[model samples]
Target: MARSPQRLSGTPDDQTSPIPGRVTAPALRRGLDILELFLDSSEGLRVPEMTAALGIPRASTHELVGALVDRGYLQPKPGSAGQFVLGVKTFQLGGAYERSLDIVEAGREAARAVAAECGETVQIVVRDERVVVYIVRIDSTHSVRLVSDVGSRLPAHCTAGGKVLLASLSPEELATLFPDDTSLLPMTTRSIDTVERLNRELAETRERGWGEEYCESNQDVACVAAPVRNPRGECVAAMSISIPTIRWQDDKRADYVALVSTGARELSTRLGARL
Candidate 1:
């Protein structure tokens, strides 16, 4: 019978080992590193393997693993005494994380339904400090839909959804997010070019309860967006529809605005917002 290979004692300065001195909790850091190790492993890990890979003392490794087991973060592998794997609690936490996201449950269905209804690309965006991130996207059947995909980031001043999200922030938050007025970088000739212009646009967006972008993020695309709110009336996201400029008509702007605003409202209601 072939024997299993022994776990090698990794060097202290090795790339895999978490560097010390940055955090105050050594034991907690070790525990987190141990958990991260499984991201690279397909099988359960043993105490000796953890100790060797992390360069932690055997007793400390055992104690940390034992504590994790007691907390239900780790469990002994089935039929393998001394080997451990992530526990049900870890999966439970992951599920909770997924469920707690308002967009995951409410925003996705709305985006899909709206895209199908309008035959245009629908997007869900969230503001990340100074930029807007596309969290979800539902594509249109048309061949000329916006090329931006989920996880794409763009300057807040240049996109309809970004403007909607930025409009939701308080004055202080806005000041903090854009400490330097020059940070509002224009993406195209039509994009908001200065902080003063962007602020005026955002104020108008707040008043109208919607935002519009034409040839801003993309020269060939035009977008309309509205804000989505959480239960506490906090704006959590923005939902938008993008259409090719060549296919856009001045007469259809109202209809497009109505569709996006309705989608945003429905998603916000699903997220427990009163409106």
Candidate 2:
């Protein structure tokens, strides 16, 4: 089957962008890009800073910066002079993302169910810049267990949810996603140490439609994960459970695996996935 055309650059810089009648103007896109960097840093950015952050020419950045400041997208901070911060409009724009009800509704149901069934921590993550962004978390029942929070970033190669997400991606896509000679950061001694090993493991995950982690992130933690696919059958996210190695023995282990699999399938069903 043919895949629908997606905007590769996401910049909306093309003259023939989308429906042909509408296109993202260069100044609007650059201004938005410059405005986005504010969320990542504590200090406000200057024209020279924006130029360096975007790699756009200093002349163009200066003009865009001026336009943004004039339009109230960027304003001066109280304590800092010459440094410009995100204005009211910027936050107002971000409020729209906060108001998004679907993501909240989906996450609330998923977090509660997974945590209730497994009696352990569960997280739903979205891939962001070769890392998994932990968006929701449900705490464990036991005193000794894994803990994670929303807005935390973890390596994609070392976590059960991350590996399941990786398995859903194509090799070509992986190559495009990861930087050259990417360093495989090991959280524990058992973390996959090389591209070759990680590749092989992800392949197995794809085949099984599930992922398992044995002290890969922490020496005492064990986890199993399965994907929550979308209506299109693409793995959009994952549901997982964390268990202490001491509890992951015998029939207890089987119970953990079964719970994770069933929970993931249920989440996928809620997402409108057929399988």
Candidate 3:
């Protein structure tokens, strides 16, 4: 007996065929393609440029760009109509990726070692706009530990780590991070309250390649910090040791500085920094 021809389940172009793996999402791919186009253009990009370069339909490009702008991945350039640039959230995501690097784990280990050696509180922080966020911390071996903990944020001007990270920024970048001088509120009487004073402090920090805070954030607390750089020699984080005023010795400042600076350098080296 002859068998009849087996008819297909659906149509020849059935998209819902039982595929074993995940399928490609055209919209997502298109969005990613649009984003990658900006990698070659640092200044700004226009929808027409994307459409012309990527061979995407003008309407689709407009919709995609609009969606990205609404989602904070792309932003309109100031004073340049129809021009787009990467948004703050994009920069934030890049920073997040940088912090998630294996070197951050090394930094954590270094922080613990430094705390054990100095018998003091240790912290590793990164700047987020005008604030410094503590990402890693190790408490002092002594009963009197510092009040700071991981995830705590403080004004960049009143903390040693904050100053160190701030010192890494260029003048224009620093100005953009701090446009309104009045936003620099004083955390304490000793805290830097003016851009001029903060500039001087940052200058000193850059000169020393380290930063210090003496009774700025807290009267009884003091800190010293050193830069932790990335492979490109950019300061990506700051490592600091905090001590109580009672335990702080004028002569021992150099020793504390050496301890933190060494730890930061070692961590930076692990992160592929030159020095």
Candidate 4:
């Protein structure tokens, strides 16, 4: 009689069974695990310490560390033997990753979301010396709205977004920008026209974590803005919402402030900021 074929035993989910077409390298996995251990370690780690932390064989840990050192992914700590830290290669990779982030696109999405929430015109701007340059704008659905467009430049002391950006600068930097305590140019009668007054408003902006302009940039327009920060916690831009003066309500100022602040925080988060 013909013999029956042998039967396979374990299910695909069994630990001992290898899945079909699934490629894995134990050595590479172990090597990566070793690198990850250093993330939580402030000081350099020795091969033995890594081996203990990762539960890899001491010999394997040595081999992996040697390979990483040779590849410039790790380097020996200064004046320390057999202890390694992340290498210059990691810094280079980090810079590349940061450079790859596109602030304009991120701001555009953030502006759209905020505009949708508040039903007002939203804008994103960056500081240019004593001025703020608009980079993104989302128009309000209302028939009447602020008409500022992308690429438009405005006095830093006269607009909410501009004030927010200016507030991010140091006192010395502000002094350098203004150069003197002379009165600034006015966009309208309500605009802040003196360095002293602008400084006071900027202080208020910093204290409240947002900025506001009432008939400053335009007689018939008012605005609120908040700062957008990057991963390094540096203010990179300002996000603002403009309201027609006729529609502006003092009672609703708090609501506008909350909306613009939330939008700025969202944009900051998208830029990799922790908060």
Candidate 5:
């Protein structure tokens, strides 16, 4: 099944090659195809599964997988007979990538600067299931402390960063996350429960380039967040700042939003995010 030239332009990223030409480069395509297979399957992959999935002959699969294993792209499972999974070398390559713009590194500088400048807690979060997990945080030096820590997961609809990230997705994608429609539990009275309402808020966040939560996750705090995107121009993370309701209502409210949005944008820039 071959396609005309025009259709090839929109070929999926998973595809290994472009239309056949000098640019096709068959070996490079095969190598990329092998690598892309691991993206969706982090778990153990057997020889047969690789062979079947790629429609490659048994001998070819063995050679490809073997070459990959020897090159440290794949590793043999400990207990399994001959199954392979992504290797530490792959992770090292990924780690180099992670370190290049590292959310933690970039995030720390922005978070700390924002916290110091604005006197509020700044945090960087990444999406995890129906929630967003706090990965890096910089707390304000104020006398009053907010209750949050890294590695902690909070409901997506209940927090500013979570809302911003969730809103980045489309209606169809959101539905896939919460199929029952009732899977969204309200953490506070202000949490968005209805899909329609959440959708509206998400649209607003996208337009404004930021999001907000008023006593949603925590009844006494107000939070603001903006999306963090990767080099590929996809939202990869979020950065936020939370202020206690008392201070949040003060004359500094306008300044807080500006400071937080600045921090978010700074972190996004370091992460290679654009627009």
Candidate 6:
């Protein structure tokens, strides 16, 4: 057997080291560096401008720029050939990150207050494609409570929070998410099982300004949810209160709706939404 080559170690930043301690991809680092250059510039940059600023060859700069544009991290400036700016995908990523931070802080406070008042489990969720992902959960004081934890993903058509988030989407967007031939999967017998029914429920949810589900996601649970809007009035998340079916009274449905809606409004306000 041949002996393995001896390793040479040095600090990652040591310029004179033959082999640095940390490994990195030069192209990736350079691509990021190019993006950072935009921080100091309000106007878009051309290939030549980026090359001069990064002190790299023009061909390398062009390749990086093309890759970024292809991945939607950058876009050509409107009416300006060869000039590029950060793309909508970049804004979306930044916004999602910022909203997540705000949601965790504001959502917890709102959910705590609601759970305390109603003695029911409260949760905050955001839509990811066709599913709703739980981001915040406040367990009920009762011994029997919802078992779904943070990061759980559920069908968007099977839960109150999911419905509320779905209701926020435009008709065209909804159509795209659920094509005519698509089947709506169910977690329980009571769950919505058809795209048509889901659409009708979403319409009602929009009309009533909230969403409600009974024995849908869980055969023994009922839930009510309202949309949490951002400063721009966009529904960024849904806040919900879940109750065990044994404790879910039809007479108290209005009260449950009111409480969850109020909780959602409070969370939205905390996130700088006007309403």
Over 139-170, each residue of candidate 3 has an lDDT whose tens digit, in order, gives 89899878877788999989999999999999
Supply candidate 2's per-residue lDDT for 65: 76
Clashing pairs in 2: none
Q: Which of the two candidates, 2 or 3, achieves a greater lDDT against the reference?
A: 3
Candidate 1 — which pairs collide? Answer: none
User: How big is the RMSD of model 2?
Assistant: 16.0
Kindly indicate the candidate among 2 and 5 with the higher lDDT.
Answer: 5
TM-score, model 3 to reference: 0.63
1 or 2, greater by lDDT: 1
Number of clashing pairs per prediction, in order:
0, 0, 0, 0, 0, 0
- What would the TM-score be for candidate 1 when compared with the true structure? 0.63
**Cα lDDT computed for each candidate against the true fold:** 0.84, 0.76, 0.85, 0.85, 0.78, 0.85
Task: Write one digit per residue (lDDT tens) for candidate 2, span 32-129.
Answer: 67776775566677777777767679989878878887888888778876688888877676565435436446865876887897788877777775
TM-score of 4: 0.74
Cα lDDT tens digits, model 4, 1-275, are 11122223222122232467664466666666676676667688888787666555899888988898898889999999888999888778768878989999999999999999988999999988888999999999999998988999998889999899889899999988887656377899999977888889999999989999999989999899999999788998999999999999999999999999999999999887867
Q: Write the per-residue lDDT of candidate 5 for residues 145-212, one digit (tens) a residue.
A: 57888999999888889988988887789889877648879988888888778778888888888888
Misplaced by over 4 Å in model 3 are 1-100
Q: How many residue pairs of model 5 clash at the backbone?
A: 0
Point out where model 4 deviates above 4 Å: 1-85, 181-183
How big is the positional error of residue 257 in model 2, measured in Å on the Cα after superposition? Answer: 2.4
- Which model is ahead, 2 or 4, in terms of TM-score? 4
**What ranges in model 1 sit over 4 Å off?**
1-102
Instruction: Name the runs in model 5 displaced over 4 angstroms.
Output: 1-99
The candidate, 2 or 6, that scores higher on TM-score is 6
